[model samples]
Target: MSSATSLPIIFVEEGALAAANLSAAHRAWADANGFTGQRGRLLALPDPQGGLAGHLFGTGPVADRPPLVAAQAGAVIGPGQFHFQGASGDPTLAALGFRLGAYRFDRYRAGKPAPVLDLPAGADADEVDRLVSGAALARDLINTPANDLGPDALDQTIRSFAADRGMECRAIVGDDLLAAGFPMIHAVGRASAQAPRLLDLTWGNPDDPKVTLVGKGVTFDTGGLDIKPASGMLLMKKDMGGAANVLGLAHAIVSAKLRLRLRVLIPVVENAISGTSFRPSDVLTSRKGLTVEIGNTDAEGRLILADALALADEESPALLLDMATLTGAARVALGPELPPLYSTDDELARALMAAGTASDDPLWQMPLWSPYDAMMSSKVADVNNAGTGGFAGSVTAALFLRRFVDNAAAWVHLDIFGWAPEARLARSQGGTDQGIRAVYGVLKQRYPAA
Candidate 1:
C-alpha cells in the first residue's frame, strides 16, 4: 500500500454498496471497477490528474461484526490519513482497531512498517494510544516462548517494567516462599529447576481506594506429574497469560494515573516434571492455612493462585480481580473470543459487562454456582484441586478460587483462553490476551483520577 496521506476511505456495506450516497461519476466508476462491497475487498479510484481519488472498503452489516472490523481495512489500505465516508459505526472504535491492526511482533524477524493512519474525527487519541501500547506489550509478552520467559525471566521482566515507571517491585523466591507461608506456591513450583517466586508490584497513594490484581504466572505447564498429552503441551507456554494481561492492564492504569492504590501479585512458576514434582493425591497447605488435596497436579494454576489470592484477600481491597488461562471447559462453553467472567457482585458484573460492550472487549458472565462447589470437596483435606465430576469444569474452577477470596468489596474472576487459535484483522494468530481492556474500562469508570 502506498504511504500517501491524502487518501480518503469509503465505507461500503455488503447490502448497501449501490444505494450509498455516492456522486454519479464515482458511483459509475465504482460500478465499472466491479466494487460490490464483499468483505475484505478494496477498490481504488483514480482522479483526472492520475492521482488517487479515494478508496472503497467492504464491510459486513454494522451489527454483525465488531467495531474492530475496520482493522481489516487498516491492514491493507494505503499508508495515509483516511477519513471515513458514510460509516455509521463508532468512529473511535474504528480508529482504535486501525491502530491495533497495524501491530506485528517481528522480534526475531523484520516486518514491514505499519502504515500511519490519522485518528478519526472525535476520537480520543490518548486513549487509543494507551490501549494500543498496553495490548501490544501484553501480546508480545504472551507470544514469547516459555524457554525465553521462565519464572526467573518473568520476575525480572516485571521488576524492570515496574522500575521503568517508578513503581515499587519485589519478589520472594525459592525457600523464601516457604518461610513466607506460601506453601501451595512452593509445592506447585518445587519441581522446576527454575525457582518459583511471587512478584509484587505497588504504586499510587496509600490513602487512595485500594485495588489489587492477581495473575497466574505458570510459565510452562507440563502438567507436573499428571502430565498433559503431547498435543496439550504445545500451547502451555501461554499458561502465564494472566500475568501478561495484568501487566498490560497495570500499564494502562498507571499510565492513565487512575486514582487508586494498585497492587499486582503474580506467583511465577514452571510446572515441570522432576523427582520432586508434586503428585496427584498430595495434600498441600496454602498461605490462607487451607489444606488442598491435589486430585490432579495438572490443575496447578488455581493452586498457585490460591496462595496469591489469599494474600490479596487479606487486605480487603476495594476491588479485586484475577485472570487466568485456567480451564478448557471455558473454551468449550464460550469458544475463543468470549472469555467467561465470574463475579461476586451483580452491580460490579453489570458495570463490567457494560464497559466491555462499550469498549468492544466483551465478556460473558457465568455463575459462581454453589451447587458445584461440593465437587471440590476432599476426604483428606479441606478441598481438592481437581473436581470429582467432569462437568462444569470452568464453574468448579471459579468456585475453588472463590473459596480463597473474602473481604473484598467486589471480586471478579476471568477464565481466559489467552490465545487466538487463528488470526484476525487486528490480532495475529498467537498469544492473544483477552478481557483486560474491558476490565480496564470498568476500572476507569469506577475510579477515574480526579
Candidate 2:
C-alpha cells in the first residue's frame, strides 16, 4: 500500500498516554481496554465502520526503549503494509527491528507470513536488506544441526557463498592442514569422521587497507576426550556460531561493496570423541610454531582459531577480529545476551562499543589482563590451550589466541554465546547473531565507500 493509505502505527510513551492525539471514540476504546503506553503493549484501533484503522503502541520511557521495540508491533500486526507515525528512537533501527522480528527458522516446519513495513524515511533500503540477510544467514547456519553442517558441509556452504558473490574461496582440508603448517587445527579436528578444514574467502581490492576476520568453526563440540556432560552437550551444535556470524558480517561488507580488502578465515572442525581425538596433556604445534599443551580437550576452539589467526596476522591486516563460542566463563561473566570483547587497541574498542550501542548489538570490553597471560603457561609446551586455574577462562582463552597474533597491527577477540536462551525484542530464542552488526558498523565507519 502507498504511504498515504498504509496502516499507521502510532507510538506513545509511558506518561504521554493521556496526551496521545486519539479521536474521542478511539480514546474511549483505548481507555476501556486499559491501553496504557507500556513497552511492548499494543492496542489495535478501529475505524468508524469497525474495520482496522491503525495501532496504538507503548514505547515506555526514552531511556528504557529498546532499539527493536517495533518488533513487537510486527509480531502481532496482521498481514498488511504499515507505516510508523510518532515513532521514537532511530527510525532506521526501528525499520530494521520490524524486519528482524519477521524472521523465523522454517527449515523443518511451516513459518508465518511477515507483515510488511513501509521503509521509514531516511532509512537506506540496501543497508536494511544487507543487515537482515546477513543476520538471517548467521541464524540459519547456527540453528542447523551438526549432522547437516559439519566441516565438509560448511566447506561447501562457504564455497557456494564465495561463488555467488564472485569472491575467491579455498580450503585446506584434513591432512593438508598439517602440510599447510596448521597442526593445531589438524589436531583438534582430526578425531571427527568428517575431516577438519580451514576455509578462506577473500574479497574487495587487494591493495586496499586489509581487514581480516578469523572465526572458530567447530561445527559440533562433543568436547573430545575431555568430554562435556549430556546437559552441556545439548547446545554444542551452535559451536560454529562464530563462523556463521563472520559469514553474516562478510555478507554485509561485500554487499555494501566496502572499499577494503577482506579475508575470512574459518577453521572448520568437529571436536568428536574417537580413538584419534587429541587427548589432554598432548602438546601440539600451531601455525605460528608455538607449541600448545592441551590442558583440556574441550578447549579446542582456541586451538583451531590460533592457527587461523596466525595465518591472518601474517599479513598484518589493519584490523584483525576473531569471534568464537570459546568459553563458558564469558557467559558466566556477562550472561547470554552480552558478549565479551577483548581488543589490543583501546581506540578500536571504544569505537566498537559506540557502534554496538548504536546498533543494539551490545558488547562489553573485557581486559586482556596481561597478568592472566601467565595462566596459559605450560612446562611441557610454549603455552597451554586451557588456563592452569579455572579462573578467568575467557581472558585466558583470548590471551591464548593473542599469542599467535603478534604481527597484526590491531586484534580483537569476541567471546560470544551465539545463542539466545530466550526471545527478546528482535532476537529469536535459538541460534542468533552477536557482535557482527557492531563490527559491521565499525567497518562501515572506518572504510566508507569511495
Deviation from native of the Cα of residue 101 in model 1, angstroms: 1.9
lDDT of each: 0.87, 0.89
TM-scores of all candidate predictions against the true structure: 0.93, 0.96
For TM-score, the strongest prediction is 2
Q: What's every prediction's RMSD, in angstroms?
A: 2.6, 1.6
Model 2, total clashes: 0
Model 1 residue pairs with clashes = none
Per-residue lDDT for 1-450 in model 2, tens only?
A: 237768988898887876678899988998899887888888999998999998998888888787878877776677778888775567788889888877788898876767788887877789989999999999999999988898889999999999999999998998998888999889988988999999999999999999999888999998899889999999999999999999999999999999999999999999998889899888888888888888999999998898899999999999999999999999999999999999999999999999998788999999988999888888988988888769999998888888888878899999999999988777878999998889999999989888
| TM-score of model 1 (CA atoms) | 0.93
What is the lDDT, from 0 to 100, of the residue 428 in candidate 2? Answer: 79
